[model samples]
Target: MTRTLGIMTEGNDVEALYRRLAWRRQIVLLTGLAALAFSLVLDVATGPAMLPVPAVARSILGLAQDRTVDAIVWSIRLPIAFLALAVGAALGLSGGIMQTILNNPLASSYTLGVSAGAGFGAALVIVLGVAIPLPEAWAIPAMAFLFSGIACAGVYGIGSLRGSSPEMLVLGGIALLFLFQALLALLQFVASPEALQQIVFWLFGSLQKATWPKLWIISAVLAVSLPLLLLDAWRLTALKLGDERARGLGVDVARLRIRSFAIISALTGVAVAFVGTIGFVGLVAPHIARMLVGEDQRGLLPASALFGALLLSLSSIASKTLLPGAVVPIGIVTSLIGVPFFVWLVIRSRRAFW
Candidate 1:
C-alpha cells in the first residue's frame, strides 16, 4: 500500500512537470504575440507622418476628426503594418515546416529557391514589359507567383527522380537558384536604364508598395495556410525524428514531403510576390522559436509565426524611422537585424536542436 501511494505521488510529480512545461510554452507564445501587437501599433504610429498611438487608434475606429490622419492611418500605415505581419507569419511558418520535414536546421522557404524564381518573374515583367491580362500592379505579382510555383515543382521533380533525399532537394534548390538568378541577370543586362532601376528597387524588397488589396490577398493566404499547417503539427513533429523513424511510426514520408513542399511553395510565392525577397525571417524566426519552445511543432509553429511577425514589424518601424523623412527599404533593414541574430544563433549553442 505504501509503495502504490509513492508511485501515485511520483506520477503526480511527472504530470505537474508536464503542466509546467506547457505553461512555459504558452507564456512564450503569448508574449511573442503581444509583442507583435505592440510593434504593429508602434509601426502604425511612427514613420514620416508620425501619429500618436491614441490618434492612430482613433483614426482606426473612425473617431478622428482629421481626414488627413484618417487617410494616412487607413490607407497607408495600416496596410503596410498588416502586410508585414502577414508576410512574416507566412515565412516563419513555412521555414519551421521546411526545417522539420527536411531535418535541416538551415532549411527555410528560400531554401527551395522560390524567392529567386519570383524575383526573375517580376524582373521579366518590369524589364521586358511583358503584358498580362491584369493591371500592372497585379500582373507582376501574378507572374512572380506563377514562376515561384514552377520553380518549386521543378525542385520536387528533380528531388523525386533522385529518390527524394534531403540532399537531393537541397541540390535541386541550388540549381534552381542559380538558374533563376542567371535569367534575372540576363534581363537586367538587356534592360533600359529606367527599367533597370525599377528592377533593382523591386529586388530591394520594400513594403512601400503595400496596398489594401495586397494586404487582403496575403491575409487570405495566411488564413488558409496557417490552419492547414497547424493541423499537420503532430505529423511534422514526427518528421523531425528522421525519415526512417517517421516511416516506422506510420508517417508516409514521401507524401508528406510532397504535400508540405506544395503548401510551402504557395505560401512563399504569395509572400515574395507582393514584397519581393525579405530574407532571414524564415531562417532566424524558427531558430528563435525552437530555442524558446523546443521541437514540439504544436507550440513551435505558432511561436515561430509570432516571432517572425515581431521581427518584421520591428524592422518596418525601424525602416521608416531610420531617417527623418525618408524611408529605407525593408529588405536592407531585415538583413541588418537578421545577420546579428543569425550569428548569435550559430555561436551561442553547440547543442543539436533536432
Candidate 2:
C-alpha cells in the first residue's frame, strides 16, 4: 500500500513538472514570435536605399504601398532577409538535432561533412562550368545540394559500418571534410583564374544573390522539414537518455538517427546550395535557445528556430551596413564572432559544454 502511494506521488510530481515546463515554453514562444515580427521590420529598413523608417513601416503595413518602396522592400531587401532567416533556422535546427542525437553540443550540420560535400559540388560546377541546360542560377544551387547529400551519405555509411562507434563516426566525418577540402584545392589549382574566383566566392558565402525563387524553394524545404522534426520531438528527447536506454524505452534508436541525419543533410544541403556556408548559427542558436527554454526538445526546437532566424537576419544587415558597398560574407562574420565565444563558453562551462 505504501509503495502504491509513493508511485502515485511520483506520478503527480512528474505531471506538475511537465505543466510548469509547458507554461514556460508558451511564454518563450510568444516572445519569439514578437521578436520575429520586429526583425522583419528592421530587415526591411536596413539597406542602401535610404528610405524613411516611417515609410518602410507604412509600406509594410500596406498603408503606403508605393511602387518604389514595394520594389525595394519586396524585390530586394525582403527576400534576402527572409532567405537569411530561413537558412539560419534550418542550420540551427540541423545543429540542434545533431547535437541531441550525438549527445554532443559541438556536433553541427557542418561537423558531419555535409558542408564539405556541398563545397565540392559547387567546386565541380564552377570548375567545369557545366550549364546543366538550366539557368546558371538554378544549376549552381541544385548541384550543390546533390553533392551535399552524396557527401553526407558517404560519411554516414563509412562511419556506421559494423562495430563503428561515435569516435569512429567523428573521425570519419573529419577525414571526409579534410579530404574533400583538399580535393577542392586541387580542382582550384587546375582551374582558370575566373573559375577560382567563382569557387572562392561561393565558399565565402553571401546573400548578395538571394532571389525570390530561391527563397521560395528554401521556404518549401523548411515547411516540410520543420513539421517532421516537431513530430519526432519525443524521440529526440528519448535519444538524450542514451541510445541503449532509448532502445529499452521502445525507441528505434538507429532509425531515429538515420532520419535525423537525412533531414539534417537536406537542410544543410539546401542552405549551402543557395548561400554557401554561413557558419555558427546552427551551433550557437540551439545553445542559446536551450539556455532560455531548457533542454526539452518540444520547446527547444521552435525557440531555436526563431532565434536562429533573427540572428541571421541581423547578421546580414550588419554585414551590409557595417562596411557599406563592401559586403562581408556572412560566413566570415559568423566565424569571426562565433569561434571566440564558443571557445570561451567551452572554458567557462567545462562540465556542461563538452
Q: Which stretches of candidate 2 lie over 4 Å from their true place?
A: 1-10, 347-354
Q: What's the true lDDT of residue 291 in model 2?
A: 72
Relative to the unseen true structure, what is the C-alpha lDDT of residue 14 in candidate 1, on a scale of 0 to 100? 100
Off by over 4 Å in 1: 1-14, 61-65, 351-353
For model 2, give the 10-residue run with minimal summed lDDT: 162-171
Which tens-of-lDDT digit does each residue in 168-277 have in candidate 2?
55667778888888888899999899999888888988988999888888888889988998899988998888878888989887788778888988888888899987
The TM-score that candidate 1 achieves is: 0.94
**Weakest ten-residue segment in model 1 by summed lDDT:** 345-354
TM-score of each: 0.94, 0.93
Given candidate 1, what's the lDDT at residue 51?
89
Whole-structure CA lDDT of model 1: 0.86
Task: List per-candidate RMSD values in Å.
Answer: 2.0, 2.1
For each predicted model, how many residue pairs clash, with residues at least 3 apart or on different chains?
0, 0
**Candidate 1, residues 1-354: lDDT per residue as tens digits?**
999999999999999988988999999988887888788888999987678898887887779988988988888889999899999988898888888877787778675687899999999999877878898888899989999889888888888887898888877888898899899999999999999998898888989889988888888888887788888888888887777888889988898888888888888888999998888999899999898888888899888888888889999998998888989888889999998888888889653245
lDDT of 2 at 174: 79
